[model samples]
Target: MKHTIKATWMRGGTSKCWVFERSELDVPGFTTDEVLLRLFGSPDPRQIDGVGGGSSTTSKAVILGPSDEPGIDVEYTFAQVGIDQAVVDWGSNCGNCSAVIAPYALKRGWVEPEDGILTVRIRNTNTGQILIERMNLDGSEAEAFIPGVPFPGQAVDIGFLDPAGATTGALFPDGKELSTLSVEDEDPRTRSDITATLIDAGAPVVIIDAQTAGLGTADFRQWPTACTAEMPRLERIRRAGAVAMGLAKTEEDAQRAIPKLAIVAPAESGSDADIKVMMLSMGAPHPALAITGSVALTLGAHHPGTLIAQQLASAPDGELRLQTPAGLITTWQRQIDGQLAVGTSRTARELADATLSFDPAGERTENPAVILAQGTGLDEQQLEPDPPPHGRRTVFASVAAFAVLGLGATLVGGGLLNPPATTADGDYAGETLEVVIPLAEGGGTDTWARFVGQELVHDIPGEPGFAPINDAGGEGITGSNRFASSAADDGTELLVSTATTVVPWVLDRHVVKYSFEDLEPVLVNGTGGVIYARTAAGVKSTRDLIDRKKPLVFGGISATGLDLTTLVAFDLLEADITATFGFEGRGPVNLALQRGEVDIDYSTTSSYHSAVEPIAKEGSATVLMSFGQLDEHGEVVRDPNFPDAPTVVEVYKDLHGKEPSGPKLEAYKTLLGLTYTYQKGLWAPKDAPEEAVDLLRDSAHELSGDEEFNKKAAEVLGGYPIVADENLSQRVKDAYTVTDETKGYVTALLKDSYGIELD
Candidate 1:
């Protein structure tokens, strides 16, 4: 008598997997491992008897269910079942497969509302967290289509919360953007350690120039020939990195999984797009990992401390195209004001005739050959006169077959590991530092906080840890509530607090449950912001704009709260300027500007400096004046990048000093100061034991002093540390304070100039 277990084999991207529901499996004889092996026909290269594809990466499984939590809608668990081994890793989440959760939930009856764009909040059971998965449905079925997957299956959009330091404890875990580890052999050489930013975005993998990896970018498709000779050496490096990142308890663990690797360089003519790359999966090379891997690598490439940081391209927030074996994967991400909002795309791959059904046990029952567990016994008397009714009803768990994992990140350091440490105040290290950041990851405040964390890992007295948790909605209210109410004064948990928090606290007053006075400042770090423009506006200079070719459309990062200042500036430029709110960052704004969608934005000078410098030098964009209260040579200096551009005061004078007023302006002023607050320190919560805070803070200070940090900072961030100055932070914060009338004026100016309406 054979026992039957149902399953559905699905293909996502280049990867394939067998998906199941928790209610599947009635076999009492098979243990969890045995059940998995039997269902997938594991431990065989052929897997001829089962749906398992031979490749290790493809031989995977996932279990999905409606979320047990109140607010969330779904739950997901991933299993990397080996083809040659019986082991299935229940730890960690797959960033790629994660894209499928919502579709799966929508197709299955686990979630409620069966119609039109349902948001299925998913809890990633593997990482112990929840993530938002947006599913587009027509009625009781899916409507959105995603690339890579077949049959135009539902397209699911995933959003990560507080991803900074998700894998690693610090955004700059090693303190330096590119640190030189003193290995005992092969010279005291310098290797890039961008684990900081990489960890911040949870892409702790290193990307070497393809040439460094001993291949040209054009040769990625010839990998079958290249891997035989060059892959082994790269594998060694990847394994070493895993150890360095502390993902592996030993070097051997790295040999199995973790610290994914990729090599990139300039793309070949007609080779898909802008840049070309080759990504590695386990030991095998990926035809293409898409922009997901690149997104992870972007942090390493852009932030201080990491090898190959210098090889990255610089462009404002927007579409970054990558050429892979499968063609192009375009990543669309940006900072709205100062927070990161990211997404990616490829031509949608429609899976045709892709349909699945489930058995009464919630297991896929479509493949008749797989029902090997069915049994026929001779009990006679009509099966003992029918067993008692147990009310065990299994409904169809037919979902679109994808999952989402968007949990609020608790800072994990070194890109791996979570451990408690005693702090300087003689308190047990806090369980975990839950940092609520008003902005999204990769924003200025978030970036600064990450840098501080990186520095602390090496310099701070304690191996203290904190992660930036982004709750970017309701202007800054959502994030602020998480911070003001949930985060305690204990030194363990802290807020990588930003200007958005201050803006709402001062202006709306109703934005958060607690006042700004309720929170305590741990330290102040650094400052950087930019006044940028897109390439298409056709206005070569401020004068060209003053000449008025057309209404120059400028964009602000936020839709409400703190964006008032930039909006006000646009108001002053209203002679020819037309502005709007809702560009997440320079990247998207740059894309929009290039596409003639918008014109200018107040981006960070430092953030855009590297990416735009080449373009600017090539005369692509005209940098406007840098705005802040900073004095230069006894007077406010114009931006060096655009010496000809006028100051805010000069522009104001030229446009007439008519002031705008109200809570909006007050909010704008408050938000503008976030750029300067970039220099402020980030720490665990105040309620965190004093000892932990001291250790982390002290270690950070110590690491900040390292010569290596200075070098990486200059190379990656394009600037050296300005060091933390409480007085400077205080002054910067003060600049945001304004009367209600002034706030209203600023708000009106912003609305008038940008057509941005704030409630």
Candidate 2:
């Protein structure tokens, strides 16, 4: 028999998951799992025959129906359809995919808005947990940018009600916060027992210390892209954790899901995140964090006995910020209706609403597909993963998974993954171009460095080895310091410079031993952004930014990076703001504003359209304020891209009734030029052979002018030009040379205003 049903594809939070009604899948002669597997074209990585996105995050499905539980609005089950396997795993929950349900309910007329806010109480049938979901139904335009989402969508606030023991009946599934798992069988070379926290809140998760995983503290900070060899060990560890949590009978009998394993380490110094994590989803590195994990981590962040609490970088007073491979995602806890509630916001967009017909029985597989048709529990032993030879594993779940495709790249000491470009003609044919990227991988700066390094070496006279090293420590300071002290002076080693690295030197922090004056510029790029504040935070206009009854809470990454400039803007305007200086990035800051955790924030020029514009249009936030651009006279001018937005200095004029002259304004202008206009660059040691530097600059000059490169780099450049002409050095010199007056003001502001004593 053929089963025809309606389904919706949704960009739910961090991923796109299919949503379907429970009634549609109740056809005779087939179980829900059998139909979904065939519909998704599983048992193959490519999934060429089906509509699946071919990754765990994208290949997820949520089945929704009218709630039978008391006080619940709807009932649903989260299913993670296996990729490259003939199985449908209903063992756990997916927090990211769960975001689509509320919006789906509204669209399908399953729920209605109350007082302009669309709220739905959803019951996860698999875990027997209830989630209170919310969004703004008053307007149709407001969007929640959950960092790195390709597009903005309705920001759904999800609160896991009484989020404890969703799966195994106890918050601490193993009857304790800490549990040790033996991974002697998974590892080929060594036997290392792993200590983990098996908490059953939201979803059962096994949080382990990265240092205990044999990578050491240094390697974990960089967030290495490839940990393929470690996946098998982690899988076995998850099985052990499942058995320990009483979710499975034995290690081999453990299902493919539940007790998700994650690598946790203390965040790097000056990092906005409270913890650094490498989340694994169904045997693959999670492209982004699972929403369920965020819920678990938030609850775990405050409990002193949990493993997450031990790795926390902050005092555990506020919301928990997780540093994922994608970026920082924020989760919070609150007392709602006198009940302890935990939640985070996710971006939700309905991608489709359609009906489809599929066979009741799925395509035949070596393993009996009919096992899913039975009403009994999943056959546990059949779900055991096929052990790859030598304990190697590859993921079918993500395009970003750490598969290490046969490209011969060597991973070296100190967390450097060197994928050397092909050597070609030039003075340095045999040499390697080691670019010191002072940021974590998968971030914008890292992306720029890798892209530029690869392309630069491709066309350089001697296309030498390309080694882009990501040394993300001390909020980009550690890598810059290392490059300053030990980089080769022969033009073979180049340091990647962005606001993160330059701001420290601008403040003349004692830790900043490298001076921009001592380095020669190869190329420079510009970037810009606008300032915005949430309307919910007593801010109706720019005037309300100062002398308000309560100060607007400002979220920032650091007091020394690009945020230094914004902080100076706050000082210049005498804006009534209490700056919280440890958000993972501006994206998280934007999310915090949406969730009312913070009030004022900024968005990069590239992300402003997708991240902030919708919210601005919906009257949730006000934009029209720019950091301003640096003109030829080194004066602040209205950013050409944001012509309608007043410059910060101009905004100052409107508020104070005149142009002001002071060190605050001077410092603001200085930071605007350094951190925005002439923000990023490539620098070599001053004593490097001029011929080598000259040749490199010439190549970059040609690259900047090339149509193909410019076209490809348009998005990365963010409407900014890459300067590599003869005058680049002089222009860069003028911008990098921070005046003594500006330096004094910044240092004092940090020390006096923020109570930060810079070393």
Candidate 3:
């Protein structure tokens, strides 16, 4: 007899799965398994007669129902149906599929919607875990785009509370932060033991260092190929880990569905993510990360001595961003009472709803046809009139039909029934915007790029989302040149320029292949700086600084970079100061000042607040002068943001008993204007269309007026005004201009004092 079941296919995060309302499936325990296996066409390598998508990621199912438990809306059981095996492993919950539960419930009327945010509590029957979903009911599509997913939809915030022991009842199943697993090898010369972290949060996970597995590269793109080649060794290690975690009584009983393995390495320099990870699902590399695995990995990152924890030792608090093959995934964890609460945002959309029908008698049929509504079934030629007993051709035909029908249904349901139309303005309507930050992650430039990119998501016309790509190398020259030479002029590509980039171009450095003149500025961000001295130097004020006998040591970078202004300021003041160059950035220089390695140092206003304010409060450092902001008349004036600190000009006049003037003063003002007043800005290729430039400028102007943005700017940019619209053009022109007299004076000063020649 033929039996039919209603099912909904949905895309959750990067994976797609078949979802079923549990109460509707009347089949009993073992019978239900048999029915689902037949429906999925499992046990055959190709699952030719079933609805499986062939790959492990697509061949998954969820059975959800209204939960009777208090405060819980739904209870869902996640099943991983093997493609080549007639086995349904309920060993773990699928994080990606779990994301669909709340949405499915809302659609099914299992949960009532509220006026604002709807909260849904879910019980994962497989792992006996609770997942809370907070959804915005504004009916607006999610604007945040994740990597790998082609479309954007509604965003759902999922929280896995106390997930540390969801599956195994213990944070570390082995009762140790780090466990050593013994591996039998063909070669005795190599290491026989591997160190791993065996923890059970959303799922049982095995964490190990990529270097230990001989995967030395931190590049995520190379991981899949490397994993495919070393599967046997990796599987052996996984089995050993399973034994260590006590999840398997013997290696033979170890299931590939449980205890997922993840190889991790420290993120490359300038990367926006704290760590780089590659996850393995069902014996193959996952193209994107698993939400369940992310939860487990997040907990491991917080646990001390674990491999993941050690790599994230310096990670910022509150949000932990990880780099995956698909892009950046941010996760947050907080301890409530004694249990750890983990949260992440995921996007899900329902694709189609249909009743699936198949004859149980034809379970072994090689070429079985699936019946769907709306004539969305396989072609007659693809379905055999007489079922074949067994053959590769039948398998091929069945799999092809499944894919074609599935895709057709999705396209028809998703409003992609027709070809996409272009916008009249030729703006970036459907294109993915890439914002390039030519600095290592966690630097000032990266921070600014991410902030601006986030704000641009809402302000830009067509509401195109922005992806910040950190191409840190060659001291900012590599990314700058790549953007100039390769980026298209369709307003989809933008470069975030900082003083690191400006200085290279201004000095005519050999490493710089791109010209500032070849770029068009859209928004210029102004930052202020303060030069201070360590209290140990005994120079409490500008007067004390002049009278001090000791020559103050200034820790700085290359003089041709941001430090050029500080160096020129030192010469103008006639203070006995010697600069020790080659510090990586302002961060290191600030550290040096605290350690007394440098008696005097300057930090941008933002850094001054976070890193230096404490030193000053502790009486370890004293502020001497602020670089200040330019007035309407283009004269250095006291910064309204830091009213207490006097301008460099004020400090100079007080120290020298005369107004500061000369070619040196002109050069100092020129470089200072370039470095502080227009330190960072947004730019596009010089040849970009005029419409694109205007759109970006208008978007930035709108963003600058946003109350939330202005509040954040006060905290990060020291309340400095964002130069946009009419002011932006003049700002760019001023920053790019250096008079011959001023240039000559700066060039001569560098050659004479620092024994360095300018190009």
Q: Candidate 1 on 1-759: residue-level lDDT in tens?
A: 355555656555445566677766435644454456555654343454455665545777777777667877877788776443333556567656676665556566666554466666677876664455555556443443333333444455555543455676765555556543212222325443322122335456656666656665334544422443454466666766666666776555663445677777765566446567667764545545633466665555445345544544443235656666545666655553355645553211222222222222322243221222222221111112111111111110001100011122365664424443334454333333344555543355555555555444434332333333444433344545545555655565566655555554555533255454454445554444556666556756555556575777765555443454565555445446665654445565665665567777665556566565666677767676555434422233454444565666565555555643435433433444443434343534435555555554445455657787877666334353544333433544455345667666755664565454433
Candidate 1 or 3, higher TM-score? 3
Question: Pick by TM-score: which candidate is best?
Answer: 2
Model 3 lDDT per residue over 313-431, tens place: 48548677988765789988875446568978888889899899856546534433321111233322233221211111233333433442233333556577535422226454554
Instruction: Please give the CA lDDT of all the candidate structures.
Output: 0.51, 0.75, 0.74
Cα lDDT over the full model 2:
0.75
Q: State every prediction's TM-score relative to the real structure.
A: 0.44, 0.51, 0.48
Residue pairs in clash, model 2: 55-397, 272-582, 425-462
| Cα error, candidate 3, residue 283 (Å) | 30
Best-to-worst order by TM-score is: 2, 3, 1
lDDT of candidate 2 over 1-759, digit per residue (tens)? 556777888888776788888887776656676678667776444455666776556888899887766778888998887655556767567787888888888887988888888878888877777788888877763586667674688888889998888678888876777777776664357766778888877777888888665445334423432344344466788888889999999888886657787788888899888888877765555656777877788887778888888887556766888888767888889876676778888888888777766654445432232332233333433343433211212122111112212223455785437534332224555456778877755567876777777778766765564656555555676567667777878888899999988887877665566788889999988889998999978787788988789998889877778888888998898888888865667777888889899999987787888889999999999884889899999789988788898999898999999996888887887888888998889998999888889888988898888888888887777768788999998888887777888888888898898887655
Model 1: residues with Cα > 4 Å off, grouped in runs: 1-434, 438-447, 465-476, 534-536, 547-549, 573-575, 632-635, 638-647, 650-674, 677-706, 715-736, 751-758
- Between 2 and 3, whose lDDT is larger? 2
Error of 1 at 251 (Å): 45
Ranking by lDDT: 2, 3, 1
lDDT: which candidate is best? 2
